[model samples]
Target: MKSRQIVLGILKSGPQTGYDITQLFQTSFAFFFDSSAGMVYPALRKLEKDGMVTKEIVPQQGKPDKNVFSITPAGEAEFAEYLHSPVEAESVKSDFLARLMFGEFVDPERIVQIVKDEIQQESEEIEQLQQRLSDYLPSHNRCMSTGQKLAFAYGINSSKTEIAFLKQWLQEHPDGK
Candidate 1:
């Protein structure tokens, strides 16, 4: 999904300032998608211009002004339209797959190291997903939060299973000794 669509989803939840959106992105959307403030700000402006959202400037005592955005009825309609659209194919750009495909020409030891590094990273990601689940599963008020929690759980479990498969593959190789 494009960053614009993701931002619109966030705004649909409630009115929020640009800074708040950035924080939300870093905390929640970091797993599924990411966008910089540069992208978010421009997208917000375009959304406002298109009548999908409205902006309000809040004056701060000692800091810069904050631009808060709230989704309109049109925005909700647009979001619903997008939700009804068919899912798009995922982009396939896996570096590990590319390496494994051409691995006959590469150093076997280095490939093992690469696999080790990837598993380590996935372990940390799974930990983060676990934390999100613990915080949200039983009592989160937001419906989307529950959806997000389940999605993260699925992702974390899938990654763990893949890692296990890779570990088994490495173990079966004599050179892994």
Candidate 2:
């Protein structure tokens, strides 16, 4: 999805400063979507230019004025249009998988080490996600949308499945044959 659409979707929840939007991308949307301040600021400018959103400047003491963005009716319509559009297939770009494609040339011990490292990384990711969920749910569960909960579940379960698959593979190939 384009950054513009994502910005619009976030604004739909409520008005937010660009920094707040960036924070959401870094935290809430990090699991499924990748975004940066570079992407968000440009999208905000474009959306404003297109009359899809309005920006309000709030003065802050000893700090730069905050640019809070609110979605316009047009922005809501555009976001809705995007939501109703056909679902695109997910594209995964994994360096590990790419390396595995050339595994025959790599030493077996190296391959085993790579797989072990991946397991460790995925385990860490799952732990962080679970912690975020636990922290989020206590206060936000009533307000959290079903889609948000499903996304959390998907992320956790998929990570767990990856760990299981990797462990099974290691068990089946003790020597990384």
Candidate 3:
């Protein structure tokens, strides 16, 4: 989804400051979406300019005033329109895969090292997601919707599959052995 639409959907839950939205992306939606602070701030500016969302300057003590954003009626309508639109296929972008594509030119030992590193990285990521799910999911999973649980499962499983593939590829190559 476009950053603007993502912001709008987030706002539907309630008003949130830019920092709050960023944290939400990091904690809640990181499994599926790659939202950065850079993407979010610009999208918020554009949404304000388009009159799709309104911002309130909330005063604070010993700190800067926060810009809290809320979706306008138009924003809700726009988000609904996007929901009704056809879903797009996800485009995969992997630098590791690109490197492996041209592995013939690289040293064989280097390829083995790369595969090992990737397996370690994916393992760490899966651990982090599992920790987050355990920490945040209330009531031992009673509070989580089926789709929310499924998204986490997808991330965990995808990382596991990638690690397994990398390990198997490295074993088959076995040039460093």
Off by over 4 Å in 3: 138-142
Per-model clash counts, in order, read 0, 0, 0
Selected candidate, larger TM-score, 2 vs 3:
2
Model 2 lDDT tens row, 1-177: 888888999999889999889977877778888667678898899999999999999999999988999999999999999999999899888998988888999899888989999999999988888887777767444567899889989998998999999999999998999
TM-score ranking, high to low:
2, 3, 1
Question: Per-residue CA lDDT of candidate 3, range 1-177, in tens?
Answer: 787888998898789999988876887678678777777899899999999999999999999999999999999999999989999899778888898788888898988887888899899999989988887666234587787788899999999998887788777778844
Q: Give the per-residue lDDT digits (tens) of candidate 1, residues 70-163.
A: 9999999998888889988877667888887777786888778777877888889888877665654444464555677577767788889978
Q: lDDT for model 2, please.
A: 0.89
TM-score top scorer: 2
Where model 2 places Cα greater than 4 Å from the true spot, the runs are 137-142
User: In candidate 3, what residue range of length 10 has the lowest lDDT sum?
Assistant: 136-145
Q: Write down the lDDT of every candidate, Cα atoms only.
A: 0.78, 0.89, 0.86
Cα TM-score per model: 0.86, 0.94, 0.87
TM-score of 3: 0.87
Q: RMSD in angstroms, candidate 2?
A: 1.5
